[model samples]
Target chain A: MTTPPPHRPVPQPTQRVVVTSPRTRAPRARRPYSGTREINEQSELGAVYMRTLIRAQRRLGLSVCLVTTGVLALLPLLFSLEPALGRFRVFGLGLPWFLLCVATFPMLLLAGWFYVRQAERSEREFAELVERP
Target chain B: MTSGYAVVAVLVVVLGTILVGAYGLRVSRTTSDFYVASRTVSPWWNASAIGGEYLSAASFVGIAGLIFAYGPDMLWFPVGYTAGYLVLLTMVAAPLRRSGAYTLPDFAEARFRSRAVRGVASVLALAIGWLYLLPQLEGAGLTLNTVTGAPDWVGALIVMVVVTVNVMSGGMRSITFVQAFQYWLKLTAITVPIVFLVVVWQVHGAESLTAPEYPAFRQDTEVTFNNDTMIHAERSLAIRGTGEVDGVRVDGGFVLTDGYHRIGQGSEFTFPKDATVPHLSTMAHNTNESWALPESSGADFPLYGAYSLIIATFLGTMGLPHVIVRFYTNPNGTAARRTTLILLGLLSVFYLMPPVYGALGRLYTPELLMTGQTDAVVLVLPARVVDGIGGELLGALVAGGAFAAFLSTSSGLVVSLAGVLSQDVLRLGGVRGFRISAVLAGVVPLAMTFVSTGMPVADMVGLAFAVAASSLCPLLMLGIWSSRTTTVGAIAGMLAGGVPALTAGLVTMFTDTGDAWYEVLLSRPAAWTVPLGFTVMYVVSLLTQRHVPPGVQRTMVKLHAPENLGLDGSGPGSGDERS
Candidate 1:
């Protein structure tokens, strides 16, 4: 059993090594380290992340809004196209009255509920991705 | 109706609001609390407060009045008002909360990084606040005049004083509790009467509710004109009346021939039970037989007016200074979003009751149509239907609710307006500055109400929405989403959009040009002005790309990033990222 000389360079397995300046070190691979601050400090990464989040959020918002808007916009047209529908009554109330006055609100609430759920989910996913270890 | 009960009810509401304000004052010790309730309001409380403030005199009484007078087409007002939150929930709520800006002007300065843009935004906010406040004051005057026989100015003055004092004393912190309590108070005031009214309708056979033709007086009715009124007659009819008819001094019975007939002030007219109600010239389209018909009343281009109203209300809520400022009270972006979701529910439940009052008013208070005082239907219907002490109590409840609507909304507006005025215009940032701003914010609108007469409360509110939709809506939508939007583009867009809208609103307010095109375009400017605003913003931003704010990327990151991601997302400039 012989001890190796302290000055003698030990032969180690060849490993991949890329030269990098200490001033611009590779990003840390940890959950808290790679959160929004790191992403923000890295301007290019922040821009990409922000753009993607915005695009996703915008798409979700527009789709929900489109459906709601279409329904609202079509209401008058529907009544005009079929005047009888406006005259149609349910439970002693005029159809138009029932729809616009009573039914419209619940529909709005449902749409709002859907939007909140989807938006929160999107944010959650984005957070998870950014905070991945 | 007994005036005593109504007077008592109004006094109670005024006192309640003051008490709530004082309670809030006890807790609000810092400038932050004064502006954003120290950014600690929970979602439920904030949502309730928003509901209290957002349901103004327009929602409390005007929608029902419009529906009773104009029929089904007016239902769009409530629908548009409530659905506006959906737009806010999806696009602006979370990001706006994340911006950490207390007022619309704060947001403008932060996003554009330009004091010039902030100045423009502050001016627009003040204008919109004043425009919105005008209707609440007028509606208060109208409600008081109807209930207690007080001159219109008394009610306006009462509301103005109460709201100004509340804001001046405690600011947003105190108003938050006052508004939240008012929301529930308004709901109860509106809902309880509605239930009884519905039962009354059912007992009365609901026959008038389903009237296919023009509404008729169910019994011999005598209507006294408090003010001179011009009514449109569909066909010739003879009426027993006194005072000037169509400018002729009639001592006895007179025949009101076809076309327009003017009824002099203090004139009394008796109509037979089955005679068709003469439509007020102000409510032109309502003369048609079918109640279910979707015709626009008094609007030159009916379709355009309707669509413009829808667009204005749907987009305008996000831009409202008071409503937007409430979002900043939420603890975080998620809470803001949650608050919006809750607001939709609370507002929907509250809105469902107004139309019932309208339908019932058409049955019991048809005389309102002739007097051009349809707005009085809510205050008058309970007594008209229910008799004795019960009726008086119900009427008082409604009066209280009406006052609550006026107080909560005006207080919120004054607070937001004062915040912007002090922060941006006066460059003062203390309780004293806020008080001074409060007086300025409230008094101008109060003065305007005196000069402006006969404008429907709902219609006046619609004008404010048009201005907001044209100006601030474009700013918020572009500022949050488009990183390329420059300060020059923002200022240019706001001025180009807001000035024209404001001019149109003022013209519509002061003049009644019965011409179709002018009425349609000027009365509902949002359809054009909003698009113009967005286009100008986009084009100008493209042309002035070099002037895009330097911190835009960082701001975008702050706005879009999740709060739990451990980033400094709640500020204007992003902090350094050092691990």
Candidate 2:
């Protein structure tokens, strides 16, 4: 085998350093910074990035959806399995009414809030990775 | 009801919409502005606009009516409707925005590189748009007839003309602001009335509204049948009124036996307090408890129907042409996702108000059950519950809100339908072509309003959702996620899913059927059709792997990639990297 090429160390900038030179290093060619943009330019990189993002999103989405749909589906089953459940009331509102009408909104909102927070977090992580040298 | 106040309210909304459109026209100088407001709509504003357009007469008037007629089970309508956005936000919103296509058909053509797929998508969009539009027109007619006693067609005609004019004048730019404004207006109109009505209910002594008995008129009530009505009396009904009953002219004090009785057009029936309210013959055949209990409502296959409705509304929202088009207004994928998040809140708040109206309607406006015009319960409740000028004012507010709902949603649908019609079918371009398409879009649905009768507004909207869910939901999901989706597979999936759903929708719309399994199957096709669509697409795509679009890899990257990445996301194989 031929001799291997030498590895070059990546330049690491220190936070404390403040270079005030007017035109140091020819402005560094204005490289694209966004991770998404980097992936967009490189098809192989893009494929990996997309797979990760989609997988995370789909996993989170499916979990939330399954939970929500489970509750909704179980409601009728609960009623059928235990007829007395329908008669069960909280604050004079029937259990089904209270659950389906009044309670469902907050639950759905919470689910949405959870989803948005998680999704944005995933994006932020991806963005940070893309920004790293 | 005071026709003058209601008419004034309606005129204010119509004129306001027109003025807004004219203003948008003045500002919209570029084609980009007309198509997507230069893709600069903020999340909150776009969310509100989406909420405005999404909460059509179905949500505004029909949900309340359904709850009143069918009880607690109908609560699913609002729940399903609101949750639909959650589904959209999770699965489709970001990718769809990143696709950067102006319409659903555009997305299809871009994804599959198949004009045939685009053609089918265009037809489905038009069909779904029109199907959705029919209800807004019908609701307008119903509202006008109830509030002003105008002939049914006049209200539909007015709405059609106004929507067409607005769309032709300014396209989507004007509609964005108008719809966003209308969302707040609608929320206030609905919420304010409910606050007063609920206070009134409490002050009048909040009696147990959940007594397990059929509804009884709380006070003396007069019901006018605008069209011929068949009422099923559980007990003999003694009425003092004038007009024709069962083809006999009764001056006063007519008795309807415990059976079906026909009340002719213009017939008026006055019922005494505490009398059991007669049920509409159309709906009375089913067993429903007075308290609108969940399982006791005697819906045929309630579980199946409920699950199907959930499937349709949840999966179906992303496929609505008007709704999907709004996603294109977002500046980027992030904004699109943010808009959906905000929309969930807006829609949840708005949905909360309708159930209050529905519950109050059941308490105070039981006579609607007899007229089978339960959908008008939301309009009539404010006047019935509140007293004097305040009542009239609240009634007018509700009227204004209802008109706004009709106008905003119908206008959105018309804009979307016109856009597709102009681009695909008419093969026309520019503003003038859009104008002609606008007229075509509005007139056909307006004509449908006259031909169809007796179908509840929400049910009609549901059929539209089913069709959308069956066809476009599969197309959108698979197109974005799966690179192996071939053009043949896409076409096959759409036909397998859409045709059956469409046929079912058409059959349900045009024909009346007894309580049969086939009828239920046709009426609620989403449960099966959606699955059928996915299965066909998946299996066919697997079999025809060789025919997969050559550029799907790049397209997938563009769709899932962040907009900041600067990939060429315009279409497949056009990967011009923007620095």
Candidate 3:
């Protein structure tokens, strides 16, 4: 409208204003993926929580393993001595009854429960770790 | 009276299993399906299939036979076999499922990136498969010859044909269904007859048990050597008299006499000279005997041996070519874990039954131990205690179940071998190459069966475990847990561990050392070989750690991370996901 020259206001190359001064450069160098690296580092905080969970799970498993081994060692002796035990029954059962019922079946169930729960927990923790912000 | 019924039954079970397996084949379009049914199998189904495959001919006939011949000590086989699964569940099952490999050879290649290691694994898998297959074929021959008087070769041929048909048609998917169904059949066959036989025994009571003679003069149970010679060992038994041993009567038995007490279904016995030797040539007792208390040595050995054997079996289960392939059928690692747990349950329950059989054998078939028919113990049980129709029906059911066991396990092993073979060797060509490779894989074993002499099936299975424990077990455990494992270490460990286990097992098969120390070493090689494998892997890994590959850290993260985390995700303290 005012008959400006061909390019009209070729804006002065905006004063080359720089946030970082030449004399005092930034303390941290710019990483290739600054955003992603920051996010990953932040998410690592969750690792401690996950580690605790995993440690507890492993402790639980080791405890059970030791107990089960002890029980298995004792079973053969007890079952062998059943005839000499004088009609003794743990709960309304004979020597065979105690072995099959109280000992074998129950122990198997408990072990199975432990495995299922631990597997699930481990998987859940893994998923949580992956999905973290 | 109908001779053709047994043959027909064999055909129906074989064909039916194949047809069902074919139905499963429709869903198998990818490599995953061919190798592991895409990993979606539920635990119940997987457990059943595992049960089906786990119960080999040895479990069916040999176990009962052993129980019949020996006393309760023979129960160790089943107990150890099942307990191995528990060890697997706790230690290696989930980790192996996460390995994402198709076969043991595949795992070897991935862990060490060494063709040499893989070659060793492939050869071992093939050898063990073939060695195990021999007993199965022999069992089929024995069953056919014993039950229907068919030629032994015919029985072997029939099994080979049926197994080939099922395996070739469906691969892993098809076999999965076949094995699951077979497990149920096996359970029913065993349990139903036992119930009926017990009822018959209780009803018939003590009368049918004929007392031969009190304190029949002591007899030595002797084993034949090369059919031309004999070996004798002194044995003492509390003579229950010449009672009905498997529906047969003895001449004298209130007391033990120096002779083979119980012969065949229609046979008699007389005291023979050289009482230190088992039944003399003319006398019928060709089996051995010992005081019952002395024989139940399941507790006698050091616990270390027991624990080591259990660990070997448990760790070895994950490495078994046939068993590991089953996990490939599952949809994810979670399902694989569940499947393992279900397997544990099935194994535990089924295993309980074996000890009962062994205990019962102490009362019935002590001679089985002497004759080394421990594998046939399960098959002969019903007939011995139950009479007439019930026993026949039970026997038939057990036959079907035993056939299932042999077929499922053999097919699984063959498929694993074939998978590795086709991938590595046959890949040079195409589909035609694959077919040829399959045939070659099977034919070698079939030939080997003809050449192999007889051995106990349980012992053969145990040797397989020992081999697996020494080689594949260490590779897997270290590959999953240790960061420094190098290709060289793996190869060295595999060779060092594998050679000893195989050598000892084979030696035990061909030679019988009179010395107890020599006998124990030949029978149990795991005690030495497992540690040797671990040591080799660790030493080699440490030496090679400086040249660790770039992807190791990432792979470690993936391996150690939780399931929900995408494998691509960065671990804690990892600055960049890509790095």
On lDDT, the leading prediction is 1
lDDT of 2 by residue, B474-567 (tens): 9998888777899989989988899899899988887777677678788888899999998998899899999898777678776875555444
DockQ score of the complex predicted as candidate 3? 0.08
TM-score of 2: 0.92
Pick the winner on DockQ between candidates 1 and 2: 1
Candidate 2 docks at the CAPRI level of: incorrect
Q: Give lDDT per model, in order.
A: 0.83, 0.82, 0.58
- lDDT assessment of candidate 2: 0.82
Candidate ordering by lDDT (highest first): 1, 2, 3
TM-score of every model versus the real structure: 0.92, 0.92, 0.76
TM-score on 0 to 1 scale for chain A of candidate 1:
0.70
User: Residue-wise lDDT of candidate 1 within B193-244, one digit each (tens)?
Assistant: 8888878777877665654566678788877788988888766777887888
Residue-level lDDT for B395 in candidate 3: 63
Model 2 ranges off by over 4 Å: A1-30, A33-46, B284-290, B569-577
Between candidates 1 and 2, name the one with more favorable lDDT: 1
> How large is the interface RMSD of each prediction?
16.6, 14.1, 18.6
DockQ for candidate 1, please give it. Answer: 0.18
Q: Over the true interface residues, superposed, what is the Cα RMSD of model 1?
A: 16.6
User: How accurate locally is residue B365 in candidate 3, as Cα lDDT from 0 to 100?
Assistant: 43
